[model samples]
Target: MERRPRARLELSDRAWQVLAQAGGNVAVLHRHLTAAGGQVPSLASLYRVVHRDLEAGRTLPDRAVVRRDREERHTRQAMADLALASPRQGDVAEAVLRLPRSSSTAASAVPVGESGAVAGVGLPAGAQLVRTPSVRAVAEPVGQAMAAEGAVCVFGDPGRGKTVAVRMALSVVPAVWKVTWVPVPVRPSVAGMRRAVFDALALPGRFPHTSALADAAVAGALGEARVLVIDEAQRLPVPCLEYLQSLCDHPGTRITLVLCGAGTERALARLPQLASRIAAWQEVPRLAAAQVAPVVTGFHPLWRTVPAEDLAWIDQSCAHGTFRTWAALTTHLQNALLTTADTSLDRALLARLCQRVAPPL
Candidate 1:
C-alpha cells in the first residue's frame, strides 16, 4: 500500500496569509513560499503537505498582528476554530446554521475561480431572479426541491454563477432547510467518478464496482427529496449522467436535478434520454460587453479591484465565450490584487496577470 506523506514544515506568517488567500491550491502555496524567500518544494511534495493539512483540519496559525476589531477578530477565531467541525446535509447542520452574519462592510471578499465557488455574490440587474427568464424558470423548481429537502445541484460553466445562484436561492429557503455546499468532482473514469460523488455526499457505504455503487447510491437518494446539485455536469461520463437521470424516476423522490454547463444544449445531445427527461432547462449566457459594466459594478468589492480594461477584456472574451477561460482570467486578476498598492488593476497589470495565469491563445 502506498504511504501518505508525513513531511511537515512550520509555516511563516506570509505562508499562512497565502494559504488563506489561495484556498487549497498547492501550486499557489509553492509560489508564495518562493516569493517569501523560502526554498520551494516540489509540486508533488507540496501537494502532499497541503493535502495533509487539509485532512488534519489545520488552518493558518494565529497571527500576532491582531489587526481586526473585536467582532471581526471573534469571527476569524470562530472560523478558524470551526474549520473541520461543519457537518454535511444529512448530518448535524451546524455550519449552515451558524454562518457568520454578513458585515455591513466586508473586510475582504474572495474571487470565485472556474473550479471554486464564490461567496457573498450578487446578480446583475437584468440578471435579477425576478426578471431573468432563464434564471427565473430554473429557480422555482430548484427552490421547491430545496424547501422539501436541502441540497441540490446547479450545474453550469465554472464562473457562470451556478453556485452563486444556488446560494442566493437557498438564502430564501427556510432555516429548517439544512443547506451544505460542496464542489462536484470533475474526474474522468466511472470508478473515480463514483468515489468522487460518494466522497462528496459523505455517504456511509462503499462499492467494489462503479456501476453497482452508482445505482445503489442513486436509488438511496431518490427515496428522499434531497437535491444533489452537480455543477460542471458536462464533464461526467455517460454512465454517471445516467445515474442522475435515474433519480428523476421516483415520484416521491422530489429530487430536483439542475444541470448547467457551457453549450449545455449541445452537450445534452450526447444524452438524448436524459436530456428529454429534464423538467426545466436554463441557459445562462455570458454577459454581453454592454452588460459587463453594471455586472462588475454590482460585484463584490474585491472583484471591483480588477481593472476596468481587464473586466472589458473578460466580458469580450467570455462573450465569445467560454467559462473555462473566464475563470482562468479571474484567478490572474485576483493574484494581482494581492500585490497592487493603489489597490486597483490597470490594463498593463491585467495583461501581465492574464499572461502569467494562462497560456497565450
Candidate 2:
C-alpha cells in the first residue's frame, strides 16, 4: 500500500497573532505556541509554513523587515524626544542620522585625497587610502564579529593602523546594523565608561544618576542589534571591562563588542571572562618591506614621483612601514613642495622630515 504524503502544517489565527506580537520572531512564536499546549509543529516545520505564507503575500512581515521598520520608528521618536529635551542634542542626533548607512554611501562620504582623517590621525590632503593586506586582514575578522554578534579584539603597536583599519572595515557594514564607536576616556572608571556608552549611543535625555537606572536605560536601548566599538580599550580598568561585559551579557541585548587599542590584547588577557568570549583576535602589523613602495606611492602623489629605491631606503631608514609615519612624511613632503618651489624631494630633505616624525631609530 502506498503511504499518504504528510500534510503541510498551517498556522492558526492565534498563532499568527502571537507571531505578530513577537515582532515576527519565529523562535518566540514557536515557544508561545508550544506553551499553549496544542498540536504544534517542529521549529523547522513552522519556519517552512511561515516562508510559504510570506511567499503567498500574507500580511505578516519577515522578522528582518519588521525589525528595520521598528528601529526606524524608534529612531524618529527618539529624535523628537531629544529635540524636546534639548535642542543642541537634537541637532546632534539629526546629524548622526545623516551618517552613511551603507558601505557604498560610506565609501563616497570620504573621498580620497580629501582633508578627512581616520581615527583622528591627520592625513595629508593629497594622500589617498590604499587597501593594503593589513586592511584586508582586519576586515575579515571584523566582518566575522559583526555577523556572529560576538566580540573581536584588534590590537597592534602604536601607529600600526589598527584603529584606522577597524574603522574602514566597519564603514562597510550593512545598513541594518547599528555601529556605536565609544571613545574610551583616559583612566576611566566604570561610571565614566557607562556615561561614555550612553553618550555614544546618543540616547535621549540626561544620563541617569544611579548605576542601576543607567544600566537599565543602556540595556533597553541595546535591545536592538548593535556593534559597540570601544577604541583605546586598553585604558579601561577591570571594573569598566566587567561593566561592558555586563551590557553584552544582558539577555535582551544583541551586542557585538569590538575592543581596539595598541595593547588591547594584553588588556583583554587580564580579564579572562571577557577574553574568552572574543570570536576573533586581529593584529595590524607594520607594512611589509615589499608593500612600502606601492602603498606610500598610492598614499600620496609626492611618493609617486619618488623612485622605488628611494622609497625603500626611506622605509628602512625612518618610516619603518608605519602608516602614521607615512602620513606625517607625506604632509611634510606636500608642504615642502608647495611652500618652496626650489625645494626638491631628495634623500637629504626626506631624512630631515623623517627625523621630525619618526621615533629614534
Candidate 3:
C-alpha cells in the first residue's frame, strides 16, 4: 500500500489567532472557537490542523509531544503485515466460547514446550482444542457440576482466561444437551437476563410481563439436560442473580448454571440466596513467570524464535503473568517484527515493542 499524506485543513486567520492564544492546545482552541461564535468543526478537525502545523515546525513547543504521539500511533499498527486468520462464524457470543459440540477434540497431552526449536504452535492449525492448565482446571469441574445438576462459579482477575477456560469445558459436552449463554447487560436487571435467555433459546413470543410466567417459559424451553453459561456475572444485579438461582433450584428445571466473571464471589456474596446454591467455586489464575516462554512458543509463530531470556524479560516487562498482558505484548511484538524485519529478538527491541503501552518499557 502506498502512503498518503493527510489533507491539511486551511483554518481561518482568526482560528490561527485563537490557536496561538491557546498555546497550540487543540482542546482550548476548539473551546475558544465555540465561545467566539464561529462555526467550529469537530475536535478531530482541530487536531488535524494542530498536528499538521507541528509536523512542519509551525509550533515548536507542541512538536516534541506530537511527534512522540505520532511515533506511538505508527508503532501500535506495526504488526498488520503478519496477521493470519482462519475465520469461521457461529454464535454471536456463546455464554462460554466453545468448539461446536459436533467437533471431536483429542485431549492435548503435549506438555508445555521445552524444546527451543523455532517452529510454530506445535499443534495442528485446525485442532479443536487449545489445552492449558487453566483450561483443564475450569473445564473438568464445570463438566462434573453440570452432569450432577449443580451450579458452579468460576472467578478471577480480569483477563485471567476465565472465558477461554469455559470454552474448553464446553468442547466435550455431548450433543444431546442444549446450552444457553446469557451475557449480563451493562446495568443488569431481572427483566434483561430473562430476555437474554429467552432470546438464546428462541422461545415462542415476547418475554412475559410477569416474572413467574417468564421463569416457567424458560424452564420449559430448557428441557431435562441443559446448561446456562453466564459470562460477566460480576456485573449482574442482585435481582438478576436471584432470578438465575430460581431457575437453578427449580425441581422441574434441570438447568445447571455456570457463571464466569472477575469478582463474582464478591458480587454473589451480596446475594446470599443465590450464593448458597453454588456447588463449586474455582479461581482461574494467571500464568506463572517460569511458564511464559513455552506458553508463548505454543501460542503463535512470532514468538517461537524469540530467545528464552528475552521471553522472560517480556514476561516481566509487559506480560506481568496475565494472559491479556501476554496477548498485548504478542500484538506489539508482531507489529515490531513486521515493521523492522528484525532477525532476532533483543532486549532493546523488546523495550521498543512495549514503549507505546508501558512506561519506557
Query: Which candidate number maximizes lDDT?
Result: 2
User: Residue 321 CA error for candidate 3 (Å)?
Assistant: 1.1
Q: Which candidate is the best by TM-score?
A: 2
Show the colliding residue pairs in model 2.
none
lDDT of 2 by residue, 1-361 (tens): 9999987687889888678768777999889878889777889988888999989999875667666666656644543343222212432222122112222211122344222225454567855565567876787777666656789899998988888777666655545568888988889998899999999999999989898989999999998778899999999889999998998889989888999999989998889999999998988888888777666665665676788888998889887878888888888787887898899788889888888886665
Q: Give the Cα lDDT of each candidate.
A: 0.50, 0.75, 0.66
Task: Give the worst 10-residue stretch by lDDT in candidate 3.
Answer: 79-88
Q: Comparing candidate 1 with candidate 2, which one achieves the higher TM-score?
A: 2
Query: How many pairs of residues in model 3 come into backbone collision?
Result: 2
At residue 138, give the lDDT of candidate 1: 47
Two-way lDDT contest, 1 vs 2, winner: 2
Q: Which stretches of candidate 3 lie over 4 Å from their true place?
A: 1-129, 341-344, 359-361
Q: How many angstroms is residue 225 displaced in model 1 relative to the true structure, after the best TM-score fit?
A: 1.7
Q: Which residue runs does candidate 1 get wrong by more than 4 Å?
A: 1-141, 144-158, 175-197, 205-218, 300-359
lDDT of 1: 0.50
Candidate 2: 10-residue stretch with minimal lDDT: 98-107
